[model samples]
Target: MGRKHTPFTSLSRRKRRAKTLHIKNLIYRERDRLGGIFFDECDQVAALASGRWTWSDIIFLSQDPAIFWNAEIITANVAFADAVEDIAFNEAFSKLNAAETQQEMHLDFTPDVSSNGKRWLRKPALKYPQFDGLTFNDFIDKRALEIARDNPPAIYCGYRILPGYASGIGLQIVVEADRLNRAVIETAIADFRARGERNWISDVPARVCYSDKTICTPLKIKE
Candidate 1:
């Protein structure tokens, strides 16, 4: 006989789908807004480099109609970005807090990687006009550094196996985020689980053991 589907089961599945869709939409909206800001910043940097306008002049012109309109757009974009970040952080905090347990906690910290497959190692030490003298490549580095400052790495709490242990363990994994958001936590958990599975291949013994404390540690991702 085929298994029966209850009305409650159907409703639960629909709710899950709705929640997933909502999260995805939030991620997409955030990406779009941030991308827009990035391009706008890049353009502003380029213009500043060309000596088209000084920061002082730009500040003074803030009340000009054209400049004010541009400022309004950027302001709206920033507001949206802030709203999305708040939502993501609140959801992440609640989820992590709910997973708190009495197990020993291990720490994992890794450097942030860029889309170009390079590690962002430079610390954010320079400010606006300092960046004005930078080359295009250096400008990108400065931008990344500023982003790191704004979105300090997110630390995710979860359970995982320690490096040499055959048993599971609790861990606090620090993941670098271009933007501190819930997606970072989700990715960290998935990566941690994948590393645990890979390590298990070598740790197999005469008897397989499992424990509630067993959590997987993340393997370093190669640059």
Candidate 2:
């Protein structure tokens, strides 16, 4: 009698290992990306203030999806930090029973613009957004809890195979896929070029990175 064949193949094992490694790298890569963007933007903003770079340059750089999303997270963090201090001061005032003056603290954690991609912090809002009757820290703490739940340590690696194309226009696409087909890739590229053509009057090149083997390239797919 023929020996029983195992279900798991050697190829499957290699793919599994590759995916695991990819995810681990993504965790580190994402952190570095966020940090790099923050520091880089800090420098850029300083340059703009100092007249070393014009507003046009800063605006151009902000067009990149990666930079834009990172900036949003950084902005949210800064806003949250500033709010904490004010909250603490107000809490101290409230504790002093001298006067029952109602104090109002408003926090708008929403981003000015959507990054069209996943960032370290997305959809940041106060857990108790309304701040009905809670202390400053209490409201802030609740928001922190919500943020922790929404933005976990894990990284999503579903869209790495696509290009890094970006248009100065608001429209953008950033996604990851485990396996991409020819039609999907072509469609994405076509859409990307179309957006560039529509918004970017000048000829600007689009970028593509096929980090995963499962992603089909135009050449390979045609073959």
Error of 2 at 174 (Å): 7.8
List candidate 2 segments past 4 Å from native: 1-57, 61-102, 106-134, 150-194, 197-223
Global lDDT for candidate 2?
0.31
The 10-residue segment with the lowest total lDDT in model 2: 214-223
TM-score of 2: 0.19
lDDT on C-alpha atoms for all candidate structures: 0.30, 0.31
Candidate 1 per-residue C-alpha lDDT over 1-223 given as tens digits, one digit per residue, 9 for 90 to 100? 9765433223344553454344344334444532311111223333334432211100001111121101101111222333344544443334323223111022333356654545555443322233465533355544444443465333222322323211111132333322222233345445644564222222211111111121122222221
Q: How far is candidate 1 from the true structure (C-alpha RMSD, Å)?
A: 25.6
For model 2, residues 1-223, the per-residue Cα lDDT tens digits are 9865432122244553454344334334433432221112223333334432211111112222222211111112223333444544554445534322232243334444566543334333223223666654565455544443454222221111112223111222332322222233334335544454232221322222211112111111110
